[model samples]
Target: MTKDLLGRHRAVLPDWLALYYDEPLEITHGEGRHVWDADGNRYLDFFGGILTTMTAHALPEVTKAVSEQAGRIIHSSTLYLNRPMVELAERIAQLSGIPDARVFFTTSGTEANDTALLLATTYRRSNTILAMRNSYHGRSFSAVGITGNRGWSPTSLSPLQTLYVHGGVRTRGPYASLSDDEFIAACVEDLTDLLGHTRPPAALIAEPVQGVGGFTAPPDGLYAAFREVLHERGILWIADEVQTGWGRTGDHFWGWQAHGRSGPPDLLTFAKGIGNGMSIGGVVARAEIMNCLDANSISTFGGTQITMAAGLANLTYLLEHDLQGNARRVGGLLIERLRAVAAQVPAVREVRGRGLMIGIEVVRPGTDEADPQAASAVLEAAREGGLLIGKGGGHNTSALRIAPPLSLTVAEAEEGAAILERALRSIS
Candidate 1:
C-alpha cells in the first residue's frame, strides 16, 4: 500500500526530505502513545513526530478547542486584536523567566530563531555570532548559515559571520576526557580567547540539548559558565529550546534551567511540543530586545486563532496534570531500563538523555566509530516488532533518538524499551 504512495512521493518531493524504515510506514491515525499504519498495523510511538507531539495523539481537549475555534473563525492577521494570541503570549511571558518579557509568535523554530538573530544583531550592532559545533538551528538561509552540522548545512553562504564553538557534544570533542569542571573551564577559555581575536559577536545561540545532533549535551553548568563570559562582553544569549523545553528533559521546565545559575538566557526560542501537533513557535525576550525593531514584522499564520486555541488547551492540560513531574518519574525508569538493555548489546555504544528524551549511539563492534548502517538496521527491526522510533546524529546519523510523548505511562515505557532491546540485540 505504501509502495504505491512512495512512488508518488518520490516523483514530487525533494530528495533531501528523508524518510525512515526500508519502506516508510504511512501513519493514518493515532491515540495516546500508539499509532496505526496504512496496513492497520498498530505500533507504540516513541519519536512523537520528532518530539513535536508533546501531549498525546488525538487528545480530546486539543481536538475540541480546535473544532470550537474553527467553527467560529480561524485566520486573522496580526493587524487585528487576537485574544487567544494575547492570552497565550501572556502565559508564555510569565513563564519565560526573563524580566519584563515579551513574546513574538512565529510558525516554526526557524522563523523564531531568525527573529531572534534580527533582534540580537540589531541591538548589539554586530553581525558576528557564535554557535556550537554539531548544532542545528533551522533550514532558513540565516538559520542554516549558523548550523555546524555538515550534513544539515547545504551552503557556505550566510548573512551573518558565525564561528563554531566546542562543548555541545560531551563524548567526542577534544575536551571529552576532561572532568565536568575542567571541560567548562576549557570551553570558557576558548571563548574568551576567541573573542580577543575577532569582532564582538551579537550573541551566542545554542540548543541546550542538540536534538538533531543525537541528544548530546555538555556538563550541566557549562552554559552557566559561558553565560558569565558572554554577559561580561555585553553579548546576548539565545537558547534554542525547540526540543528541550516544556519539561521533555524530565528534570527541568526548560533545558536552559540546568545551566541557569547565572540566570535565564537573554532570548529563548521554542517550537515542536507546545502546540502538540499544531504549528506554533515563538521567541521570548526582554521588552528592550523584543521592542528594538522599529519596522513592522508579522507572520501571516503565526498567531492565528485556531493554532492558539490548540496551544492554550495543550498548555493547560500539560500544567494542570503536572506532566513535567510525570516525565521526571516515567523518564527516569525508561532510561535506566534502556541502559540495562544496552549493556547486553555490543552495537549499543552509549545511552544518554534526561527526562523523556533519550539517544542510543550505535557503533561498530569494539570501536567508537559511528555505524549508520547498524543504526538503520535497528530502526527497521524496531518497526518490524510493532514499535516506531527515530534516528539522528551530527556524525553520519548513527544515533537512535527515543523521545516518547511526555504523557507516556510506565507500562508503555517498558513495552517500548523491550521492543528496542530486541532491535539492539538483532544487530549484535
Candidate 2:
C-alpha cells in the first residue's frame, strides 16, 4: 500500500517535494504524541510535522474548535468582519510585546514574511535587505530572496538586493573561535563594514534559531548587539519566529526574547505551531510600520474563520496549560538524554537547541566533515524502531531535527530518546 502511494506521489508531485525514509509512510491517524502509518505501524512523532502540532496530536480542543467553526463557517475572506480572527489577533498582539502593535494574518509563514518585507521596504523606502547566512525563511520569491542558505534557496533573482550577514551560526564561521562577546563584536563590526559598502537596508531579518539550517543559533546577545547598530541607522529589525515562536524555545516565549536587552523586534512573523496543525501565519508590528502601505490589500484566505478559530483555541490552550514551561522542563531533560546518547556514538557531532527544537549534527568520526549518510542511516533506523525524527542542515543535510510538540511529557521524551539512542548506535 505504501509502495503504491509512493509510486503515485512520484507520478503526480514535484520532485522537489521531498519525502522521508526508504519507503515513506503515509500517516493515517494520530493521538497525543504518536501516529500510525497506513500499515498500522505506530511511531512516536518527534518532529510533529515540522513542529506544526504545537500541543498534541488529535487534540480535543483543536478538533472541537475546527469542527464547530466549520459547522458555522469555514472561510470568509478578509472582506468580512471575522470575530475569531479579531480575537486571535488581539491575543497575539498582546503576547507579541511590540508597542502599539497591529496584526495581519496570512495562511503561511512565507506570506507573513512577504508581508513583512513589503512593509519594511515601503516604510524605509529601501530595496535592500539584510538576512543571516544559513537561514531559510520561506519559499516565496521575496522570502527566498532574503534566504541565505544556498541549499534551500533556488534562485538569485530577487526584487530586494539581499545582503547576507554573519553570526547566525556561532559554531562555524570566521569568528567561530571567538568568545561570545568577541563573536558579537566581530559580527557587529562585519555588519558595519558591509553597511559601509551598500545602501541603507530596509530591515535586518533573521531566524533566532535557523530551523532548516539545523537549529543553529548565534550567541544569546548577538542580535541585541546588532539591534543597537541597526537602530542607530534607522534600519528595522524583523525576527522570523516561524519555528522559534510561541514558547517552543523554553526560556523565551519568542526566540527574540533570548536577546531581549533591546526589547521586541520592529516586526515579527510567526506560523506553524500557533494553529496546532491548522494553517495560521501572521506578522505583528507597530501600527506605524504595519500601516505603512498606502494602497489596499487583503489575503484571500488569510485569517479565514476556521483557521482563526483553531488559532484562538490553540493559543488559549497553550497559554492556559503553560506549555512553554512544559517545553522547558521536558526539553531540557530530552536534550541532556540525547547528549548522553550522542557521547556514546562516534558519528554524532553536536547536540544543540533550546526547548523542544533540538538538532543533532552528524559528522565523520574524529573529523569535522559532515556525515549526511550517517544522518540518513540514523533516520531510517529510528523509523524501523518506531520513532519518527527529521534530518536537515546547511552542510549536506547532516543534522537530525528533533522538534516535538510543546506538550511532550517526560516519559514520552524518555521513550523517544531510547529509540533514538538505539538508532544512533545502529548507524555508528
Candidate 3:
C-alpha cells in the first residue's frame, strides 16, 4: 500500500518536491510526540514535519478549535470582518514586541515574507535589498529574489537587487578564525563597506538562526550591532522568524531578542509552528511601515476563520503550558546528550543550536569536507531505529536537523537522544 501510494504521489506531484529516505515512509497519524507509519511501525517524531507542529501532533485543543470553527463557518475571506481573525490578530499584536504593531495575515511563510519585502520596498522606496548568505526566506518569486542559498534558490533573476551579507553562519566564512567580538566587528565593517558601494537598500532581512543553513547562527548580539549601523542609515531591519519564532528557541520568545539591544526589528515575519499544522503566517510591523501601501490589499484566505481559530487555540495552549520553558529544559539535555555521543565520532563535525532546533553537522572521517552521504546514512539509521528527523545545510545538505515539538517531554528527549547515539556510532 505504501509503495503504491508513493508511486501515485510521484506521478501527480512535481519532480522537484523531494521526499526523505531511500524508501520513503508514509505517516498515517500521530499523538503526542510519536507517529505511526503505514506499516503500523511507530517512530518518535523529531522533525515535527519541518517544525510546523509547534506544540504536538493531534493536539486536542487545536483539533477542538478547528472542529468548532468549521461547524460555525469554514471561511469568510477578507471581504468579511472575521471575528476569529480579528481576535487572533489582536493576541498576536500584543505578543509581538513591535510598538504600534499592525499584523497582516498570509497563508504561508513564503507569503508572509513576500509581504514583508513588498512593504519594505514600498516604504523605503528602493529596490535594492540585503540578505544574509546561506539564508532562505521562501519559494515565491519575490521571496526567492532575496534567498542566498543556491540549493533552495532555483533562478538568478529577481525583481530586487539583493546583496548577500556575512555573519549568518559563523564557522565557515572569512571571519571564521576571528573571536566572537572581532568576527562581529569584521562583519559590521563589511556591511559598512557594502553600503558605501551600493544604493541604499530597502531592508536587511535575516533569520536569527539560519534554519536551512544547518541551524547555524552567529554569536548572540550580532544583529544588535548590525541594527545600530542600519539604524544610522535609515534602513529597515526585517527579522525572518518563520522557523525561530514563538519561543521555539527556549531562551527567547522571538529569535530577534537574542540581539535585543536595538529593540524590536522594524518588521518581523513569522510562520510554521504558530498554527500547529494549520496554514497560518503573518507579518508584524510598526503602523507607519505596515500602513504605507496606498492601494487596498487583502488576502482572500490569509486569515480565514478556521485557521485563525486554530492559531488562537494553539497560541493559548503554548502559553498556558509554557512549552517554551519545556523546550529549554528538554532541549538543553538533548543537545548535551547528542554532543557527548558526537564527541566519540570523528565524522560528527559539530553539534550546534539551542532549544529544540538542534543541528548535527556530519563530515568525512579525516577531513573538514562535508559528507552528505554520512548524514543521509545517519538519517536512515535513525529511522531504522524508530526515530524520525530532518536534514539541511548551507549547500552540501549534510546537517541533521532535530526540531521536535516544543512541548516535547524530558523522557522523550532522552529516548530520541539514545536512538541518535546508536545511529551516529553506526556511521563512525
Residue 397 alpha-carbon offset, candidate 1, angstroms: 6.3
Q: Please report the TM-score between candidate 2 and the true structure.
A: 0.99
Report lDDT (CA) for all predictions: 0.93, 0.93, 0.94
> Which 10 successive residues of model 3 have the least lDDT summed?
389-398
Q: Where is model 2 more than 4 Å wrong at Cα?
A: 395-397
User: lDDT, candidate 1, residue 212?
Assistant: 92
Error of 1 at 163 (Å): 0.5
Q: Candidate 2 has which clashing residue pairs, if any?
A: none
Q: After superposition, how far is residue 311 of candidate 3 from its true place, in Å?
A: 0.6
lDDT of 3 at 195: 98
lDDT for each residue of candidate 3 in 70-128, tens digit (9 for 90 to 100): 99999978998999989998998898899999999999999999999999999999999
Pull out the clashing pairs in model 1. Answer: 249-355, 250-355
Per-candidate clashes come to 2, 0, 0
Compute each candidate's TM-score over C-alphas: 0.99, 0.99, 0.99
